[model samples]
Target: MSERLTLPIGPQHPLLKEPIHFRFTLDGETIVDADIRMGYNHRGIEKAAEERTYIQDLYMIERICGICSHTHATNFVQAVEKILNVEVPPRAKFLRTVVGELERIHSHLLWLGVAGHEIGFDTLFMVSWRDREIVMDLLEIITGNRVNYGMNTFGGVRKDMNQEEIDETLKGIKILEERTLYYEKVAREESTFIARVSGVGYLPKDIAIAYCAVGPTARGSGVNYDVRRDFPYAAYDQIPFQVITSERGDVLGRTLVRVGEIFESVKIIKYALKNLPEGPITARVPRKVPQGEATSRYEAPRGECIHYVRANGSEKPDRVKVRAPTMANLMSIRHCLLNQQVADIPIIIAAIDPCLSCTDRLILLKQAGEKEGEILTWEELRRRSIAKKPL
Candidate 1:
């Protein structure tokens, strides 16, 4: 009989599973069971929002995830605006959508490059990221930043689009479209790429739906629901696009969904630029928000990012809760890792395109009745929960 052993992947600079600890029970490289733990990088962003005013929280929420910063800011602004009953300017809505799609393109390309590096395909990684710089440059031209565009605000956006910027954005999208076509060909025809991802980490449709997985993770598993399509935020109601999905439900399927989303984003950006309206970008907003609670959702690059805000009759918010896409996808991700060989584990986890920074973390305590304990990081504490040997 094969001996069962535990394998740990940690930030000890070993397996490089940053911000999350994974312990797998393996029988000769065949994973028999797995344990996923959180609480490594929790910053209490949600609790912090309660202390800040509505205006201050906008930027704070934007910092939730660097890759999907705009999505976070937009959704937070939308939730607050709903409480204030403010009608965002038509042009502002369109502009916010443009930046959102641009961020999506940049994020998906980043994921593709990272996925390539995970499987030892550095050439594809280099080429994909090289093309991603075009989108980054365009974002910088419009919003003056690469990572965190800082465009979203309560009631509207901070920056206004001009003719030159619109023309430049269209040109950049064209280049990305052409490059996407080539990458699509490679993904379809490349022998080694197909072999590695195909059938690896198969997440069935039932598991995806049951776990409430959102974004590409849910879509890739044949679940046909997209927040942009169903919920319709920003200018999504005005703009037209299709949700990409696959029945394969494997790592390859999610990759295809993200690639297809890039093309769709290109289309949305072109449509928004062509139909760009002229008007004031920022709307007049009141200092004090009314007492109420609301939820805002956005189709972020990873998946569905939701923000819940509860405002009292004051400048500061009473409560603000955020649920990131990676948190939603983790359950299904664990299921995907099961029954698979250890060698394929890295790519399989990377398949969800996990943003552990967004997953954040929480406190874990171990004690007897009527006792509570503080949380600890790996560096702070070791040899924990040591049971007292039977006396």
Candidate 2:
């Protein structure tokens, strides 16, 4: 065997969109062992949520992930609504489903573009992102913004869809459907893409399950578990759509699964728009939550995203926890990286569509005269931040 080499990628690599460190041990060009170090992007959003009122927390939580802003917003609101025992209107639920599916379309298209770019297929990247603009425009029309669509509130959606907006969304969806179909054809029939992705970064079904991989990463490995279908949150129970999966268990499988989901999301949006129920959009919600804890699960584009809240009969939650899909899927990445060519690193990592910022939680600081690093609690950290004190 050739001499072993250790390579470090990111906390600041051009290929990485966010700060994360990876140490790969390679035997020649093939990776033999891999390790990951995160927390480079920690912002303490959960602690920030604890310091804000429920309404304010909604705004903060939405900022957790820009692409999946609605996902976090909806998930946070759902947890609060659960604590309040508030029932969302049928129309509101359907509308939430519509927006959720739209977000999925935009996110998947974004991922497709990124994946293409990683594989040096600029044409695919350009075309996929070009079609993604259609979904962004629809989102702007419906929710008044593209990235952070402030659609969710405590009880239900903040805005209701009008006939004009519905018509326009349908028009956009039609174009997206046509474009997505063409892309699907490419994913299925394109020889170059197939050759580049097939058998690359293989994550076997058992390894995927054992690693607790979520979303497309798991689905690509034949783990047919979708939060929308299995748990059925929001209006997912009422919406009719298939859970996309692939048994190929490689980069190709993940690509195919995401493409299939784009079609499914289109179907869901069409169904929700056509069969929208007539009712009030928002329900009356109290300002303060009762003493209780609740967990909210959402099928974000990346995978199963969960939010947990503990209320202390106050305006703000006593504890708030968010489990982004990237965090769950990240566990399986090393397995996929092992024995893979070093050139395959980017694509393998991209296969999970990780949002590193969403996964960050804590950052330890070494204070002056302290031998060990200090781990600050949220309250202490907030106090120090307010006082402008260095840890």
lDDT of each: 0.88, 0.92
* Candidate 2 residue-wise lDDT, 2-41, digit = tens: 7999999889996678999999999989999999998888
Q: Candidate 2 regions off by >4 Å?
A: 363-391
TM-score of 2: 0.93
Top lDDT prediction, candidate number: 2
What would you estimate as the lDDT of candidate 1? Answer: 0.88
Error of 1 at 79 (Å): 0.5
Residues 98-165, candidate 1: write the lDDT tens digits: 99999999999998998899999999899999999999999999999998888988889998988899
Off by over 4 Å in 1: 12-17, 361-391
Clashing residue pairs, candidate 2? none
Maximum-TM-score candidate: 2
